[model samples]
Target: MDLAQRIQKMITPTIKDQGYEIVRVQITGAKHPRLQIMAERADGTCIDVEDCATISRSISAVLDVEDPIEGEFTLEVSSPGIDRPLTRLQDYQTWAGFDVKIELKTGIDGRKRYLGRLLGLDEEQRILIECEEDEPHTLAFEDVQRAKLMLTDELIAAAATEQTK
Candidate 1:
């Protein structure tokens, strides 16, 4: 497995035990790698500074023991924020009806990028996206390269209401 995936496997249990979910784990920069761990409450609540600090300490302890990274690396723990990434199958289903930007691994119909309102997953587990000009596009789950919600007034309002609930 890759470095990020290996690290995730090691740290996920600890995060889950703390009532949080790992959204994504990314390693960037070849020379001085930066490990970024995006996380959130299991109930979909936003993470605070205290939450980050807590996760950081927990992950640090695990990393120190595991010795996953070879050299010096910076670990960053943070929330996914309002316009969060759609990294898993459940994320697409959960964020249905929201505007999203998705990049495919390969071009479909001469396009590799698309922006549309998410229609969730179909029976075949394909993601459905309804664009402005045409019929909804169905994408294979494996085809997704990157997907993220688009910031909008509707999204902001939903987040605010979720916070109050």
Candidate 2:
């Protein structure tokens, strides 16, 4: 229903047809909005510049016909990168055991942010994070406003291992 969701819906098929999965779609700025589309290879390989260009072209074609935006906007296509935003529930599972920073839509016990090791999702699909405290914290997935992997040596090594595979 929102701009990003609309854009994602419009371009998802095209992107999937090209063997890519969209990671996230975001529209920012007021004067000249920027449409940022983060995507990854469906095969789990690293995305390259050529991949970005191909996705950009495909998305541009769809947007050109749909004319979704009221005014001029910039379309950017890129990979999720090493420190990627966890936009989907699957992302949490995929990146489990890594350090992450999660921000909630509303504070819990006067705390709005959490930094800890991701323990993946629980049976109810709620997020499980092991903070510095004694017990792990359980958060509702829907309550998470934004979350991203923390850049660390372990993450970098994991990314390298994945790329080499």
User: How accurate locally, in lDDT, is each candidate?
Assistant: 0.95, 0.93
What would the per-residue lDDT of candidate 1 be over residues 1-165, giving only the tens digit for each residue? 988999999999999999999999999998999999999999878899999999999999999999999899999999999999999899999999999999999999899998999999999989999999999999998998999999999999999999888
> Could you give the C-alpha RMSD of every candidate to the true structure, in order shown?
0.9, 0.9
**What clash count does candidate 2 reach?**
0
lDDT of 2 by residue, 38-107 (tens): 9999975669999999999999999999999889999989999999999999888888999999999999
Pairs clashing within candidate 1:
none
lDDT of 1: 0.95
Taking the candidates one at a time, how many backbone clashes does each contain?
Answer: 0, 0
On the 0 to 100 scale, the lDDT of residue 120 in model 2 is 95
